[model samples]
Each structure stands twice: as structure tokens, then as C-alpha cells.
Target: MTYTEAAEYILNIPKFTTKNKPEHTRAFLSFLGEPQERVKVLHAAGTNGKGSVCAYLHAMLLAQGKTAGLFTSPHLVKINERIVINRDQISDDAFLDIFEFVLGKVKEMEAEGLPHPTFFEFLFGMAVTAFASAGVEYAVLETGLGGRLDATNSVQHPLVTAITSIGLDHTAILGDTLAAIAFEKAGIIKPGVPVFYADTTEESNRVIEQRAAELGTPCKKIGKDAYEILGIRDKHIAFSCVNAYYGNTTWSLNNIGIYQPGNAVLALEIMRFVFGEEGRPDLWREALHELKWEGRMEEVLKDVYVDGAHNVSAVEGFLRSLPEKEANIILFSAVNDKDYEEMIACLCRNVDTDFYIITRIEDKRAAHTKELQHIFETYTDKPVFVRESLEEAIDFALEHQHGRKIYCLGSLYLAGMMKGYCNSGEQ
Candidate 1:
């Protein structure tokens, strides 16, 4: 099948919601000759900062003259962006080659009476094969959802396992409470593995601590063991890494956000563990200078910023990271069934900018404009109205907006659509 056809075929399959076991992935890998064991994996799992932490770790790995493989989900612009190696996407030729190989193996599985691999399972297998084929030294993986039974968890060994701040997201699948969610994320930890965690609520920390104890893993949590602060004007952030293999040094951050201190320290801590003391410091400086995490607190254009903050924790981070002031924002959103109303309320309360709500073109779960308007009304009767299309929404914001700082908030699909408007080939 062609690339587009392959993507559509993957999407058409019915989703398998339960985290039954890792056997599905294992079976598929066996069929493909077990390509997963060839690379060193750095696995990251959490609610808010998975993308940023993965980006940072991948960048640092590349700077150390190693071929790094990055696997993320729900692409902001192009499907190829989800699977990158050495800061470049897996090309059409490479994508097609491995997919066909995996599909053939999948058909063999079905013939042998095994269950069909789910969409995420297929993606995970493809990622493992691609990384092996490219001979990458390190594969930086971000879990698609919760961790306990995530398709990517078949890798019981990783150089380092990081758990970003746990928060209430994917509540139905993960659990209702932060502690429950932390337990799911902690699934990536194994015996003797060094765990790097960022700032988590006290309740969440208890759950993580329990899991680490059960696994017999030594953990270094960001805010608890190491910490950072934003420099003058927040153009830079600094962190002291006492727990890190790097010497006790205060790092100056290139990503501008007060909320970044947690993820920032987590990334540094991973580098310190991955490399020895000297390599950690050098890689840290190089990666921070070249860090580019799109859709999650990213500056896409000269004056416009975009963030895919689809849940309460991410929304809170977006608001906390930015200057507290009212500005015009081009907002487009699409969330899972569980988070729509709460996400709307969080956006309206903390992000008090002029919002232009746009409708998503393709995704089925997108909320209608009238429904969004009603939610906005519940927060305030202010005229942060809706637009029919993404172009119209951007046009509305551009026409009414007065200053250099432009912002876009809400879902990854929204960020992808607006990224279409920016019209750049890069993600």
C-alpha cells in the first residue's frame, strides 16, 4: 500500500482499549525476527512533558555523535514527524519498506490464530524495525498513553527511564486519581534501572515511590533531588543537578518557560545518567541550544506561539509559562471523550486571552462551535467567539490582534491544522 493508504488503513481498524498484556507486541516482534533488541532505548512516560523531555534527550544524544531514533505520536503536521532519526524524519521509502514487512508478518499472525495487532501496536513494531534497520545507537521513545500495558513496554531494558510529572489525563483508561496514573507511568521502571522523575504532586509521589520500591529501582526526582529557576525575564532557566552524574552545576535553559524547570531538570538528569560526568555537561549545553519541541510550548513563527495543551495540567502549564496578560489567541481544540468540558473551563480561567475557536476538519470527536461557545459562556460571557474553519479562525485572530505576541492553544489536531497554515515543510 502507498503511504496515505497505509495511514488510512491503520486508522480504520477498531481500537483495542484494554491493556491486556505485551504479548501482542512480542508476537509481532517474533514474526519480524525480533528487531527490538538491537538498540539502546530511553523510555519516557507521563502526562504533560513527555514530548519536551524526549526532544531534549534526543537532541543531547545526537550531539554526542550518536544516531538517535525518536518515536512520538499524534503528529502536529506530518505523519513522518512521529518517527524521526538523527533529527530527520523517516523518509517515504523507509516508511513504506518497513510497513510492508510488518504487514506481511501481521497477516501471518492472523493466519496462525493470533489477535490482530492494534494501531498503536503496529506503530510500535514499525518503530523498532526502523531503528534497527538504521543502526541507531539510541531510540528515545515516548509512550502513547499510560504505561503499564502500553504497546511500547515490551522493551524491559532501557538505558534510562524517565517519568514526567503525573497529572489527571486519560483518566478513564489510566484511572481517576493522580496516584493511579503514576502507577501506570511507573510501569517502565525495571530492577536496577535508574529512574528520573520530575515534579509530581505529593499524592502522585507516594504512588511512584511505592512502585519504585517494588521494582527495586533507585530514583532521582527533579524538584526533590534537583531544582532550577528562570533567569532575568525568563528568557533563560537554570537548574542545579546535585543528583546528576554531572557536577553540581546550575544550567541556563534556552527554552523560555517557568513551568519548564521540572522537565528541564528531568532531561538533564537523564543525560547525566546516560553519559558520564564530562559528556553530560557538554551534551546538556549543545542540546539546550538546539532544542525544538513543536506543539508543546513552541514558537512556530516570529510572532506566533503554539501549544497543544489539551488537558488541565498542560493548560495550567501553558498559562503558568506565559506572561499573565490578555492577548488575542487562535484557539482550536479536539480532546478525548473524558476531557472536553474541563479543558474548556481551564483554558478560559487561566488563559484569559481573546480566543478564536475553530472547528476541526476530520477528527470525529471534535466539539461543535456552538457547544464550545456554550462552554465559553459558562466561564464568561466575553465574546471569545467561534469560527467555522481554521483559516477563518486565523484570519479572525490576525485581523483583530494588535501586538507581536500571537498564541494558539488547545489540541494537537488544532496545532497540526494551524501548522498547515504556516505552510512550512518542517514540523
Candidate 2:
């Protein structure tokens, strides 16, 4: 089958079957020869910044001259973006080869009356299998959802685990309160494996500490105090860690997001654990200075950027990272499952935007453009425009910029569509 057809088959699996139990995932991995066991895996989980943390780890591993694989979620552009080795996405031929093999396994399972893997599970299996075949020395795995029962959690052993900032997301499945959500994220902690986490809140930190204690694992918390932002200049944000080993040296990231320093520091601490005295902070510094994570305040066009900040907490971070009191134009869209109203309210209250444009993402769960427009109209006196088509919304935002920057945000799907449009040279 063609690569497109193979991807379609995996995407359609979600429509027919629900997520299987953890045992099912473990058993499937076993059937696939437990490829995860062949590599030193670094598992990362949290509400936000987990993907960034994984990217940082992968970059650090590469800087150290180790072959690394990165498995992330909600690819901003293509399915190949979800799996990368040595900074390159898996080739279409490689993807189809693995897809056909996994498809055969799924058929065998069906013949034995076993449930087929869900969309995420099938992809996770493919990532590990590909990593194993390539003989990568390390693999960075990001949890798809809440960590405890996530398909990625089937990897019973990992060299280390890290948890990024925790917040109220996936409230129905994970939990509503911060502590409840923290418990789910902390489930990634395994006995004797050291875990590092971003110290987001007192309540959440307490839950993670308790979980680590119960598992008899060493847990280190990296708080905001661990690093201080120096400044943002020339499309880069510079920060200095409090760790004296760095000797007050400032580290800069290619992207200007304010929250990235925290994510970078979390990855730095994990690398310290893994590499000890042999860890080359200089190499890591250079790697981060050159790294650019797509869809996180990524500038797709001149002064036109897209961010994947669909949840309330991520929106808060996005607001914090924006230039204070600068008038901007926001092109926003979100899925129905998100708290888009609260996200809108937060953006309207905090940001000095010239106006707001609302559009719908290309997803079955996308919120209607009219609904988003009404919500924006309620929150701010700023002119709210509705465009049923994302392309029209982009055009309107650009024409109405009036020298103000344009930020398209609210959903990864929206970011993906915008990036695809920009890359297609249609913008």
C-alpha cells in the first residue's frame, strides 16, 4: 500500500475501536519483539512542554555524538514529523515498510480475536520498531496523554523520566484538580529510576514527591528559580541557570518563548543525571542555541507566527511570552473539547490586540467559527471577525495587521494547517 493509504488506515482505527488496556499494549510490544527494550529510553510526561523537553533531550543526545530517536505527538505538519532519528524524519519507504509489518501483526491479532491497536498505539509501536531497526542508542518518548495508562507507558523500564509543567487539561479523563492531574503524570515514575520534574505548583509538587517516595525513586524538582531570563534579542531568548557549574554563563535559545528556558533546564538536569561529569554543557548550550521547535511561537512568515496553545494553561504561558502591551492581531481556532472560552477570555484580558479573527480547524471536533466569534465578541470590545475558511482568515489578518504582528494559535491542528499553507507558497 502507498504511505498515504497506510496512514489513513491507522487514523481510521480510532473510529472503530477504543484505547486498549495497558496490558494489551505491553503484550503487543512483546509480540513486536519489545523494541523499546533495545534502546535507552527517556520517558517524558506532563500537561504541557513535554514535547519541548523531549526535543531538548534528543538535541542534547545528538550533541553528545549519540544516535537518538524522538517520538512525539500531534505532529504540526506531517505524520513523519512524529518520528525522527538523527534529526531527520523517517522516510516514506521506511514508514511503509514498518506500516506493512505492523499491519500484518494486527491481522494476526484479529485472527486470534485480539483487539487492534488504537491510532496512538500503532504509531508508538512503529516508532520503537523503527528506532530499533536503525540501532539508535537513545530514544526520547513523549506521553500521548495522561501518563499512567498512556500507550507509551507500556515501556516498563526507562533510563530516566521527566515531567514538565502540570495543569488542568484532559479534565474528564485525567482529573480536574491540580493534585489529581499530578498523580496521573507522576505515574511515570518507576522504582530506582531517577525522575526530574518542573516544579510548577505547591499542590502538584507534593503529589509528584509522594509518588516518587512511594516508588523509592530519586526525584529532583527544577523550579522557576533554577533559571533566570536574561533577555530576548534577535529572535532568541537568553537565560542563565543558577547552577554554579555553569558559572553564571548565559544560554540562549533560537526561539523566543518565555517558558522554554524552564523546559531547557529540565532537560539539562536530566542530562546531568545521565551523563554526570562527562556531560558537556558547552555542547548542549550550542545545540539549544540552534534548536527551533515548530508550532511553539514559530514564525512561519514575516511577523506571522503560529503557536499550539489550545488549553487554558498553555494560553496563559503564551500570554506571558508575548511582548508586553504590544498591539497584535490574533487568528485563533480550537477543537470543541478544549476550554476555548476561557482561553479567549484570558487572551482578551491580557493581550493588547488590534483585533481578533476566528476560524475553524479541519477536524470533526472543531468548534464552529461563529461560536468562537461570539465568544471573542463577549470577552473584548475589539473587533471580532469570523472567517469560515482558515485561508480567508489568514488573508484578513495579514491585510488588517496595520504593522502589528499576527499570531495564529489555539490548536495544533490550526498550526499544522497554517504551516502547510505557508509551506505550500499560497500565503
Candidate 3:
């Protein structure tokens, strides 16, 4: 199949299926000769910050002169962004070739009465296959959903596993309570594998600790005390770490959010655990200072910022990490499944936005603009605008921007759609 046809095939399949079994992935991988088994994996899972943590790990690994692969989910733009080797996305030619090969394997499985893989599972398989073909030494995997039943967990072994800050997300499937969500995220911790996690809420910490102890796994909790913050300003952070492997050496990341320092620490701890203290501090400094993971805290225009803060915790971080300057307007959208009520409340209560524009995004899961505006009304009495089109939303936000900042947030789908518009010079 051609690239377009392959994409159509994958996208046509249900985004998520009720059956989240790993057996389908196992069977499919076996048919493809078990490519994931060939590479050393670094499995990461969490409700938020998994993508940034994986991006940091990929950057640091490459800086150490090692071949690394990155597999992330819900691409902001193209599907190729989800699969990368040596910092480059899979090319159209390579994607088409892999799709054709994997299709053959799928047919073989279907003939044997095996079930088909979901959209996430198929993409993850392609990433594993591509990584194996490239002979990457390490593959940094970001779990699509909860860790326990995630397709990425099909990988038998990883050099080390990390569970970043866990919060209440995917409450319908993963569970509603923080402890229940933490239990799901902790599923990546394997027997005897060294696990590292962010020192987050007490509920999450207890769940993760208990899971690790049950498996006799050596677990380390990287808390605030493990790192000393030197400065936080201008959407950048500088910190020094006193963790077990890392000395109290100072490091800084430019053009990133305040919440990123913790994620960076998690990635650094993983690198230290796997490759030892041989990594030069200079390479790390250069790499992190220039690290770019789109749609997190990306500035699409001169004074406008866009973020994908769809959930409550992420929205809280976005609001907390904002510069002290007041924002002129906030354009937002979120899928129906998310807790947009709490997200809206957080943004309204924290940041003083003169205008709030609720817009529709390019996703079936998106909450309607009217519905979102109604929810926002309950929290804030600010002037709220509704626009069905993203371009119109941008226009409205800019028209109301009186020299203050225009912040677009709420959903990654919205962020991606806005990024595309901005790149096309349509802003």
C-alpha cells in the first residue's frame, strides 16, 4: 500500500478499542520476527509529562553518541512524528514499506483467527520494526495510555523504566481515583528492573512504592529535595541535582516550562543509570538548551504561546508556569472525555485573561464550542467568544490582543491545528 492508503487504513480503524489486550500485539510482533526484542527499551508511562520526558531522554542519549529511537503518541501534526530514529521522523518511503510488510503479517494473523491490532498497537509495531531495522541501541517508548494494558508494555525488557508524575486522567478507562491511576501507571515496573519515578502526590507515591516492593524491584523516588532550583524565569528553568548518580552540578533548559525541570531530572537519572557517569555535562547542556518538543510550550508567533494542556493537571502546570505578565486572551478547546470543567476553572482562577475564546478542533472527540463556553461561564464571568473555525478563533484572539499575550491551550488537537495554521502563514 502507498503511504496515503496506509494512513487511511490505520486512521479508519477505531482509535481505541474496548479490548486492550496485549496478546494481539504479541502475535503481530511474533509474525514480524519480534523486532522489539532486538533493541534495549526505556519504557516510560504517566498521565502527563511522558512525552517531554521521552524527548529529553532521546536528546540526552543522542548527545552521548548513541543511536536512539523515540516512539510517542497522538502526533501533533503528522503520523511520522510518532516514530523517530536518530532524531529524524520516518520518511514517507520507509513508512509505506513498513506498512506493506506489516499488512502481510496482519493477514497471516487473521487467517489464524487472531484479532486485529488497534490504531496505537499498529503504530507501535511499526516503530519497533523501524527501530530494529536501524539497529538503534536504545528505544525510548512513551505509553499511549495506562501502562498495565498498554501495547508498549508488550516489550519484555527495558534497560530501565520510569513513571513520571501521575494524575487523574483517562478516569473512565484507567480509573477515577489518583491511587487507581497510579496503579495503572506503575504497571511498567518489571520484576527486578530498576525503576525511577517523580515524587508526586502521596497517593500516587504509595501505590507505586507498593507495586515496586511487591515485585522486589529497586525503586527510587526523585523528589524536590533531589534537585535544587537555581532560577525560573522567562519560561526557562535552571537547576542543580544532588541525586545518587548525579552530582550537585548545575543545568539549565531554555524556552521550556517550569514543570520541565522535574521531567529533565527523570531523564537524567535514567541516562546515568544506563550509561553511567561518563556523559559529559557540556554535551548535555548544549543539547537541552536547544531541545525542541513542539506543542508543549511552543511560541508560534512573536508574543503568542500555544500549549496542549487538555487535562486538569496539565492545565494547572500551564497556569503555574506562565510568566507573571497578564494574558490578553486565552483560546481553548478540549475533548469531551477530559475534565474541561476543572481545566477551565484552573485557568480562570489563576490567570487574568481579558478574553476567553472557545473554539472547535479537528477531532471527533472535541467538546463543542457552545458546551465549552457554557462550562467556562460557570467558572468565570469574563467575556467569552465561540468560534467554530480555528482560523476565525485566531482572528478573534488577535483582534482582541491589546499588546498582551494570546495563549492558546486546552487540547493537543487544537494546538496541532493551530500550529499548522501558523506555519502556513495564515495567522
Candidate 4:
């Protein structure tokens, strides 16, 4: 099948099947020759920052002269962005080849009366197959949702597992409390595998610690106290780790997210655990300096940025990264499942934006522009404008920026839409 046809088919799979059991996924992997077993894996899961952690680890592996593959979710522009090797996306031809191979296996499974893989499961299988086929030494896998039953969690063994900050995301599926959510994330901890996590809250920490203890696994927690942010310099956030191995030297990231330093340190600890003495802090430092995870405080244009801060906690982080004195203009959109009211209240009360522009993502889950506008109106006296079309919102934000920084946030889908629109050269 052609690339377009394959993508269409995969996207429509969700209509036919929901998430399968981890055992089902494992059996499917076995049917596909157990490609995940051929490569060492680093699995990461959390409410936020897991993708950033996975990206950092993949970059470090490449910097150390190791062949690596990175698999992430919620592609910004293209499905190809979800799979990468040696820092480049799987070529369209390679994606097509892998798609056809996996489709053949799915047909065989169906013929035998086995269920077909879900959308994420199919993509996960293709990613492992691609990585093994290309002979990658390491593969960094990011969970699409909660860790306990995520499709990526089907990988039974990983060299190391890391969980970023746990928060109240996907509360419908993963519990509502921090401790409850932590339990779901801690499910990725395997027997005897050393697990690293960002110690965000006391409740979450206790849950993770207990889970690790139950499995007789080694666990280390990295907290906010582990790193200190110096300042933002030249559009980069600079910080220093408290770890003695990192010394008193300050490290800088290419992006301007204050939360990134925490994510970076979590990846650093995982790398140290996996590579031991072979891992060079200096090389890893250099790799982090050049690392930039898209859709997280990414400056897409001259003074316009797109951030994936859909939840209340992520919006709080996005707020902490903004400039204290500069005038700002925010273009916001969110899906219906998110706590957009709280997110709007947090942003409205925290940042002194000149005004707010509300838009709707081109998805069925998107919150209506009028609904978002009403939320913004209820929170602050700031002028709120609504544009149902994302393209129109972009035009309005840009036209009225007036030398102020423009931030597009609230959803990954919004970030992806903005990036795709900007990349289309219509801006």
C-alpha cells in the first residue's frame, strides 16, 4: 500500500478496536518475531516530560557513538515524527515498507481469529521492527498514556525505566489522586530493573518507592532540589545539577522551559545508571545543550512560540517560563477532556498578557472557541477574542502582536496545527 493509504488505514483502526491487553500486545510482538528483544530499551512514562526525557536519552546515546532509535507520541506534523533513528525520522519509503510488513502480520493474526492491534500498538510494533531492522543498539520508548497498560509497556524488559513528574492527567483512566496516578506510572517498573523518577510530590514518591520495594528493584528519586536554575540567557535556560559527578558547572538547554532542567536531570540519572563508567557527563552535557523537543516551549517563528501545556500543571510550568516584564499575547485552544477552566484561570491570573485569543483545534475532542472564550472571560478582565479557525487565530495573533511575544498553547494538537500552518509557508 502507498504511504497515504497506510496512514489512513492506521488512523481508522481506532474506530474498530480500543486498547488491547498488555498480554495481547506481547503475543502480537511474539508473532512479529519479538523485535523488541533485539534492541536494548529505555522506557519512560509520566503525565508530562516523559517525551522530553526520552528525547534527551536518545540524543545522549547518539552522542556516545551508539546507534539509537526514538519512539514518541502525538506527532506535531507528520506520523513520521513519532519514529526516529540517528536523529532523522524514518524515511517515507521505510515507513511504507514497515507498514506493509506489519499489515501482512495483522492479516495473518486475523485469519487465525486473533484480534488486530490498536492504532498505538500497530505503531509500536512498526517502531520496534524498524529499529531492529536497522540494527539500532538502543531504543528509547515513550508511553502514549498511563504506564500501567500503555501499548509501549508491552516491552517486558528495559535496561532502565524512568518516570517524569506525575500529575492529574488522564484522570478518567489513571486515577484522580496523585498517589493513584503514581501507581499506574510505577507499573512500568520491572523486577530488578533500576528505576529513576522525578520526585514531584510526597504522595507520588511514596507510591513509586513502595512499588519499587515490592519488586526488589533499585529506585532513585530526583527532586527539584537536585537542580538549580541560574537564569535564561540568549533564549536558553541554564541550570546546574547538585550531583557531585556533574560538579559545580552550569549546563544550558536550547529551549526556554524552566521545567526542562528537571527532565534533563532525570535523563542524566538514567543514562548514568545504564552506562555506568562508560557514560561521559561531558558528552551528555553537550548533547543536552543542543537538544530541543518540539511542542514544548518551542519558538517556531521570530517571536512566536508553540507550547504543549494542555493540563493545569503543564500550564503552571509554561507560566514559570515566561518573561517577568515583557508584554505577552497568548493564543489558546484545548481539547474537551482537559481542565481548561482551571488552566485558563491559572494563565489568566499568573501572566499579564495584553489579551487572549481563543481558537479550536481541528479535532472532535476540541473545546469550542466560544466555550474557551467564556472561560477566559470569567477568569480575567483581559480582552478575549474568538476565532473558530486555527488559521484565522494565527493571523489575528500575529497581526496584533505589536512587538510583544506571542505564545500558542493549551494542547499538543494546537501546537501541531500551528507548526503545520507555519511550515506550510502561509504565515
Off by over 4 Å in 3: 15-20, 232-235, 243-248
Task: Encode model 1's per-residue lDDT on 1-427: one tens digit a residue.
Answer: 7988887776665564333368777777889887778999999999988888888888888887789899999787777788898879999878888889888998898899888888788888888899999999899999998987888888878888999988898888899999889999998888888888876788988777788888889987777546645362444556555654556565665656556767776887787677764574666675776576667666666657778877888877777777665445646556546476787777667655655455654477776777777777788655766777777776666676677466777677888877777875432
Report the C-alpha lDDT of model 3 over 1-427, residue by residue, as the tens digit.
5799998898876844446488777877999999999999999999889999999999988998999999998898789999999979999999999888887888888799887778888899899999999999999999999999899988888888999998888899999999999999999999999999999999999999999999999999989777777887566688888854455566887655778888988888888788776866568767887887789878888778888888999988887777674667899999999988889888888887787998998888889889889988988889999999998989987876768788889899988998889878887
Instruction: Give TM per candidate.
Output: 0.91, 0.99, 0.96, 0.98
Write down the worst ten-residue block by lDDT for model 4: 319-328
Ranking by lDDT: 2, 4, 3, 1
lDDT of each residue in 169-195, candidate 4, tens digit only = 888889889999999999999999999
Scored by CA lDDT, what does every candidate get? 0.76, 0.92, 0.87, 0.91
Best-to-worst order by TM-score is 2, 4, 3, 1
Task: Output the lDDT of residue 320, model 1.
Answer: 73
lDDT of 2 by residue, 199-231 (tens): 999999999999999989999999989999999
lDDT of 4: 0.91
The root-mean-square deviation over C-alpha atoms between each candidate and the true structure, in angstroms, is 2.8, 0.9, 1.6, 1.0
Candidate 3: pairs in clash: none
Cα-based lDDT at residue 124, candidate 1:
82
